[model samples]
Target: MVLSMGIKVGITDTTFARVDMASVAVKKLNEMTSKVQIIRYTVPGMKDLPVACKKLIEEQGCEIVLALGMPGGKDKDKVCAHEASQGLMMAQLMTNKHIIEVFVHEDEAKDGKELDWLAKRRAVEHAENIYYMLFDQKYLEKQAGMGLREGFEDVGPAKR
Candidate 1:
């Protein structure tokens, strides 16, 4: 159901992220369609995303949310990321809404350039996914089980 304020899409990002992923997503969404009211919330770190997202949905009337983060390479960072992910999942369950977790680990890239590239690619792709999820379920259904990856190349369907 579309709200009178338009289709409200929330984006929550972390200050710890080296790249500006939220901007990329906003640009992608803007390019894909019009009349979408994008609500953005910036947090200090990944762990703070759940509350920010929840607030966007509950308080700001957002229909869907995108939680973008960048976890460090250390083991502790991984653990923190895991915890934050759990919170995001719980928020989804509690709100009965979709919160797309877009996380890019620092170690996923070999260099700064690759990290930037991954962040932009992931943000743009996931923004498209949001469009699909909100407006084109048939398209996603047709691509089901196709091993679609956000930051990296899609693996496609498995060999039969």
Candidate 2:
């Protein structure tokens, strides 16, 4: 059954990313469930995501936010990513909501193709996560401590 009225999930992306992760995530969400109303806002860089997300949640009625970013493989970029992360956390605290951070660092991939793959995969996987957070908390609860990684393969729970 398709839901006509439901939660609004916000996507705050960065233009600094080499790949368009936001679009990939939006596609994934649409494919996964008809219950979500997706709202997107683009910023110039990772550091700008917090405000954009805050606006999406406070002004656009987003119940949860996905902050997608790609920090370059540089020392400064890494610092910026950390700052952005802190800001995202603060936003979550201030708004009393969840802001799922999906960051694919440039250094995490060895090449252009790998970077693209990582970005897209992370976005899609996180989209699935938000779906669970919104509609199926039990599913997530069941998978707790399962070592789930968004962009990479799941490392399932350790053997007893």
Candidate 3:
């Protein structure tokens, strides 16, 4: 759980909707720890996230990246989300760094209140994760005990 003082963390988000939540969270987290510097980048939409992340690492010398974008409730948004996720993963692999992708789809909630709640919650949660990723060996140890899996969610063991 140790990082050099003033470690660089890149925070990228889309200029769409209220994705500003991510920016706010990153700033708050930065203030809380004071051990990391927050580098901010903004893109027009979800599709631009990957490039932002890549530049942050390669150009900005960031150790970790937190990307936030909100996909509206449209067919195109869903498709774009998938494409963005792919790019994000690719960037991570190419750069040999961790990218915390946090996207809250517009359709995920029943109403505006829920949507707002989801977006803010996810943004803050990922920001906190950034801290853990850079400074918490105990948290990493516990994650390892959660049963690793090949695909996305750790669905535990097969239940016949």
Candidate 4:
């Protein structure tokens, strides 16, 4: 559904997992701001996500897109991930909008419990990222150093 010239955010996710990352993001977004609207589309596989996202942007007029998915650590999964990433980038260029690709590979954690934690962590973190991207990008600029440096936390502007 096309929103009429407002802050409509699109969330496209694959059906690989039962987790609805869009709902997670929407919860976070609602807590902060009510100006933004959430539109969600669910596709079957990683390769199909870009097309859905393109439709969301071009047809539904979403201002920004957040794509979420989980790819396994197999060779086939890696190749498919690469192709999907390229298509997503192309979609971003075509729409001239930011598409935050939030993907958590299936092999990222050590076990089932850890995997669940990682998936939720990554999804929530990206949701926070979307909030910042839509509202306060200066916060994101500092968070760019989050994993790049050890113990890098945004403490806001420090006293001189």
Per-residue lDDT of model 2, residues 61-157, tens digit only: 9999999999999999999999999999999999998999999999999999999999999999999999999989999999999999888789988
Over 2-101, each residue of candidate 4 has an lDDT whose tens digit, in order, gives: 7554488898998885456667767777777777878899999889989989999998888888888878889899898889899999999988988888
Compare the candidates by TM-score and give the number of the best one: 1
Instruction: Select the stronger candidate by lDDT from 2 and 4.
Output: 2
What is the Cα root-mean-square deviation between model 4 and the actual structure? 4.8
Rank ordering of all candidates by lDDT, starting from the highest: 1, 2, 3, 4
TM-score of 2: 0.95
Off by over 4 Å in 3: 1-5, 143-160
| Candidate models: Cα lDDT each | 0.96, 0.94, 0.83, 0.78
Which of candidates 1 and 3 reaches a greater TM-score?
1
TM-score of model number 1: 0.96
Q: Per-residue lDDT tens digits of candidate 1, residues 52-155?
A: 99999999999999999999999999999999999999999999999999999999999999999999999999999999999999999999999989988999
- Residue clash pairs of candidate 2: none
